[model samples]
Target: EPEVTQTPSHQVTQMGQEVILRCVPISNHLYFYWYRQILGQKVEFLVSFYNNEISEKSEIFDDQFSVERPDGSNFTLKIRSTKLEDSAMYFCASSEALETQYFGPGTRLLVL
Candidate 1:
Protein backbone atom coordinates (compact mmCIF):
# COMPACT_ATOMS: atom_id res chain seq x y z
CA GLU A 1 0.00 0.00 0.00
CA PRO A 2 1.29 3.42 -0.88
CA GLU A 3 1.56 6.03 1.85
CA VAL A 4 1.36 9.80 2.00
CA THR A 5 4.70 11.64 2.13
CA GLN A 6 5.72 15.16 3.08
CA THR A 7 8.76 17.27 2.37
CA PRO A 8 11.22 19.17 4.55
CA SER A 9 10.57 16.87 7.51
CA HIS A 10 11.69 19.73 9.76
CA GLN A 11 11.17 23.46 9.31
CA VAL A 12 12.12 26.51 11.32
CA THR A 13 10.52 29.87 10.64
CA GLN A 14 10.19 33.32 12.08
CA MET A 15 6.86 34.62 13.29
CA GLY A 16 4.57 36.54 10.87
CA GLN A 17 6.16 34.78 7.90
CA GLU A 18 4.64 32.63 5.22
CA VAL A 19 5.18 28.90 4.72
CA ILE A 20 3.99 26.38 2.21
CA LEU A 21 4.02 22.74 3.23
CA ARG A 22 3.94 20.04 0.57
CA CYS A 23 2.53 16.57 0.38
CA VAL A 24 2.17 13.70 -2.07
CA PRO A 25 -0.70 11.49 -1.13
CA ILE A 26 -1.36 7.93 -2.25
CA SER A 27 -2.20 7.94 -5.94
CA ASN A 28 -5.62 6.42 -5.56
CA HIS A 29 -6.95 8.46 -2.71
CA LEU A 30 -9.60 11.06 -3.50
CA TYR A 31 -9.95 13.01 -0.29
CA PHE A 32 -7.07 14.89 1.31
CA TYR A 33 -6.77 16.55 4.69
CA TRP A 34 -4.42 18.66 6.76
CA TYR A 35 -3.98 18.36 10.50
CA ARG A 36 -1.61 19.88 13.01
CA GLN A 37 -0.38 19.09 16.48
CA ILE A 38 1.06 21.85 18.61
CA LEU A 39 4.07 20.74 20.67
CA GLY A 40 2.11 18.91 23.35
CA GLN A 41 -1.47 18.92 22.14
CA LYS A 42 -3.74 16.43 20.44
CA VAL A 43 -4.00 16.40 16.66
CA GLU A 44 -6.34 19.05 15.33
CA PHE A 45 -8.04 19.01 11.96
CA LEU A 46 -7.32 21.92 9.69
CA VAL A 47 -9.03 21.29 6.38
CA SER A 48 -10.15 18.71 3.87
CA PHE A 49 -10.20 18.96 0.09
CA TYR A 50 -11.83 16.93 -2.58
CA ASN A 51 -12.26 17.43 -6.32
CA ASN A 52 -10.13 20.57 -6.28
CA GLU A 53 -12.20 22.39 -3.70
CA ILE A 54 -12.38 22.58 0.07
CA SER A 55 -14.93 20.09 1.35
CA GLU A 56 -14.68 20.85 5.05
CA LYS A 57 -12.47 22.94 7.28
CA SER A 58 -12.06 23.55 10.97
CA GLU A 59 -12.38 26.91 12.69
CA ILE A 60 -8.63 26.94 13.14
CA PHE A 61 -8.37 27.15 9.36
CA ASP A 62 -8.90 30.82 9.19
CA ASP A 63 -8.32 33.34 6.43
CA GLN A 64 -4.57 32.88 6.64
CA PHE A 65 -4.62 29.22 5.76
CA SER A 66 -5.19 27.80 2.29
CA VAL A 67 -4.99 24.46 0.55
CA GLU A 68 -4.27 23.67 -3.07
CA ARG A 69 -3.91 20.76 -5.40
CA PRO A 70 -1.56 22.34 -7.87
CA ASP A 71 -1.09 19.15 -9.82
CA GLY A 72 -2.12 15.54 -10.01
CA SER A 73 0.22 14.38 -7.25
CA ASN A 74 1.05 17.40 -5.17
CA PHE A 75 -1.14 18.93 -2.52
CA THR A 76 -0.03 22.00 -0.62
CA LEU A 77 -0.96 23.98 2.46
CA LYS A 78 0.02 27.59 2.80
CA ILE A 79 0.00 29.71 5.89
CA ARG A 80 0.03 33.34 4.83
CA SER A 81 1.22 34.77 8.10
CA THR A 82 2.65 32.48 10.67
CA LYS A 83 2.08 33.22 14.32
CA LEU A 84 4.12 31.88 17.23
CA GLU A 85 1.20 29.60 17.97
CA ASP A 86 1.37 28.21 14.44
CA SER A 87 4.51 26.28 15.32
CA ALA A 88 3.47 22.68 15.11
CA MET A 89 3.87 19.37 13.34
CA TYR A 90 1.65 19.60 10.26
CA PHE A 91 0.39 16.34 8.84
CA CYS A 92 -1.08 15.41 5.48
CA ALA A 93 -3.58 12.62 5.17
CA SER A 94 -5.54 10.95 2.37
CA SER A 95 -8.37 8.48 2.18
CA GLU A 96 -10.41 6.69 -0.44
CA ALA A 97 -13.39 6.84 1.86
CA LEU A 98 -14.20 9.19 4.72
CA GLU A 99 -13.65 6.61 7.44
CA THR A 100 -9.93 5.81 7.40
CA GLN A 101 -7.15 8.24 6.62
CA TYR A 102 -3.50 7.45 6.08
CA PHE A 103 -1.11 10.06 7.44
CA GLY A 104 2.26 11.31 6.33
CA PRO A 105 5.37 11.71 8.46
CA GLY A 106 4.54 15.43 8.97
CA THR A 107 6.43 18.69 8.55
CA ARG A 108 7.57 20.19 11.79
CA LEU A 109 7.18 23.97 11.66
CA LEU A 110 8.84 26.07 14.31
CA VAL A 111 8.00 29.74 14.57
CA LEU A 112 10.17 32.12 16.54
Candidate 2:
Protein backbone atom coordinates (compact mmCIF):
# COMPACT_ATOMS: atom_id res chain seq x y z
CA GLU A 1 0.00 0.00 0.00
CA PRO A 2 1.14 3.56 -0.68
CA GLU A 3 1.89 5.83 2.25
CA VAL A 4 2.49 9.47 3.02
CA THR A 5 6.02 10.01 4.29
CA GLN A 6 7.47 12.97 6.18
CA THR A 7 11.10 13.92 6.64
CA PRO A 8 13.01 14.61 9.86
CA SER A 9 9.99 13.33 11.80
CA HIS A 10 11.12 15.82 14.38
CA GLN A 11 12.79 19.21 14.23
CA VAL A 12 14.20 21.71 16.69
CA THR A 13 14.13 25.35 15.70
CA GLN A 14 14.91 28.59 17.37
CA MET A 15 12.32 31.32 17.77
CA GLY A 16 12.24 33.77 14.86
CA GLN A 17 13.97 31.33 12.53
CA GLU A 18 12.63 29.59 9.46
CA VAL A 19 11.77 25.94 8.92
CA ILE A 20 10.53 23.92 6.00
CA LEU A 21 9.06 20.49 6.59
CA ARG A 22 8.79 18.07 3.69
CA CYS A 23 6.19 15.46 2.84
CA VAL A 24 5.49 12.99 0.07
CA PRO A 25 1.87 12.08 -0.33
CA ILE A 26 0.61 8.94 -1.93
CA SER A 27 0.55 8.92 -5.69
CA ASN A 28 -2.54 9.90 -7.71
CA HIS A 29 -3.99 12.26 -5.13
CA LEU A 30 -5.03 15.78 -6.15
CA TYR A 31 -5.68 17.67 -2.94
CA PHE A 32 -3.18 18.22 -0.16
CA TYR A 33 -3.59 19.85 3.22
CA TRP A 34 -1.64 20.99 6.26
CA TYR A 35 -2.85 20.63 9.82
CA ARG A 36 -1.21 21.16 13.18
CA GLN A 37 -1.71 19.96 16.73
CA ILE A 38 -0.14 21.64 19.67
CA LEU A 39 1.09 19.24 22.41
CA GLY A 40 -2.33 18.45 23.83
CA GLN A 41 -4.57 20.42 21.51
CA LYS A 42 -6.95 19.39 18.81
CA VAL A 43 -6.04 19.10 15.16
CA GLU A 44 -6.43 22.47 13.47
CA PHE A 45 -6.52 23.10 9.78
CA LEU A 46 -3.88 25.39 8.45
CA VAL A 47 -4.45 25.33 4.72
CA SER A 48 -5.38 23.22 1.75
CA PHE A 49 -3.89 23.33 -1.72
CA TYR A 50 -5.18 22.12 -5.04
CA ASN A 51 -3.91 22.94 -8.52
CA ASN A 52 -0.94 24.67 -6.88
CA GLU A 53 -2.98 27.53 -5.39
CA ILE A 54 -4.57 27.58 -1.99
CA SER A 55 -8.11 26.23 -2.11
CA GLU A 56 -9.06 27.00 1.48
CA LYS A 57 -7.25 28.29 4.52
CA SER A 58 -8.15 28.66 8.15
CA GLU A 59 -7.66 31.70 10.36
CA ILE A 60 -4.63 30.03 11.82
CA PHE A 61 -2.88 30.27 8.47
CA ASP A 62 -1.25 33.65 8.85
CA ASP A 63 1.47 35.45 6.94
CA GLN A 64 4.12 33.32 8.56
CA PHE A 65 3.02 30.12 6.87
CA SER A 66 3.17 28.94 3.28
CA VAL A 67 2.86 25.65 1.37
CA GLU A 68 3.91 24.32 -2.00
CA ARG A 69 3.88 21.30 -4.25
CA PRO A 70 7.40 21.33 -5.62
CA ASP A 71 7.07 18.07 -7.51
CA GLY A 72 4.62 15.40 -8.53
CA SER A 73 4.73 13.64 -5.17
CA ASN A 74 6.30 16.15 -2.82
CA PHE A 75 4.44 18.69 -0.73
CA THR A 76 6.17 21.14 1.56
CA LEU A 77 5.23 23.56 4.32
CA LYS A 78 7.34 26.54 5.23
CA ILE A 79 7.21 28.66 8.30
CA ARG A 80 8.71 31.90 7.06
CA SER A 81 9.35 33.16 10.57
CA THR A 82 8.93 30.82 13.50
CA LYS A 83 7.88 31.58 17.05
CA LEU A 84 7.89 29.61 20.27
CA GLU A 85 4.15 29.13 20.05
CA ASP A 86 4.64 27.65 16.58
CA SER A 87 5.76 24.37 18.09
CA ALA A 88 3.47 21.54 17.13
CA MET A 89 3.13 18.35 15.15
CA TYR A 90 2.47 19.31 11.55
CA PHE A 91 0.51 16.64 9.73
CA CYS A 92 0.29 16.33 5.96
CA ALA A 93 -2.83 14.89 4.43
CA SER A 94 -3.99 14.07 0.94
CA SER A 95 -7.25 12.89 -0.48
CA GLU A 96 -8.16 11.82 -3.95
CA ALA A 97 -11.84 12.57 -3.49
CA LEU A 98 -11.90 14.95 -0.50
CA GLU A 99 -13.88 12.57 1.66
CA THR A 100 -11.11 10.38 3.05
CA GLN A 101 -8.02 12.19 4.11
CA TYR A 102 -4.94 10.06 4.89
CA PHE A 103 -2.51 11.45 7.41
CA GLY A 104 1.22 11.02 7.77
CA PRO A 105 2.88 10.26 11.10
CA GLY A 106 3.76 13.97 11.24
CA THR A 107 6.69 16.27 11.73
CA ARG A 108 7.08 17.41 15.28
CA LEU A 109 8.37 20.98 15.38
CA LEU A 110 9.88 22.35 18.53
CA VAL A 111 10.80 25.99 18.79
CA LEU A 112 12.83 27.34 21.64
Which model scores highest in lDDT?
1
After superposition on all C-alphas, the RMSD of every candidate to the true structure, in Å, is 0.7, 0.6
RMSD after Cα superposition, model 2: 0.6
**lDDT of each residue in 43-111, candidate 1, tens digit only:** 999999999999999999999999999999999999999999898999999999888999999999999
lDDT of 2 by residue, 1-112 (tens): 9888998799999999999999998898888999999988899999999999999999999999999998788999999999999999999999997789999999999999
Model 1 shows how many backbone clashes? Answer: 0
TM-score of each: 0.98, 0.97
Candidate 1 lDDT score at position 37: 97
Question: Model 1 residue 54 lDDT?
Answer: 100
* Cα lDDT listed for each candidate: 0.96, 0.93
lDDT of 2 at 8: 76
Where model 1 places Cα greater than 4 Å from the true spot, the runs are: none
The segments of candidate 2 whose C-alpha lies over 4 angstroms from its true place after superposition are: none
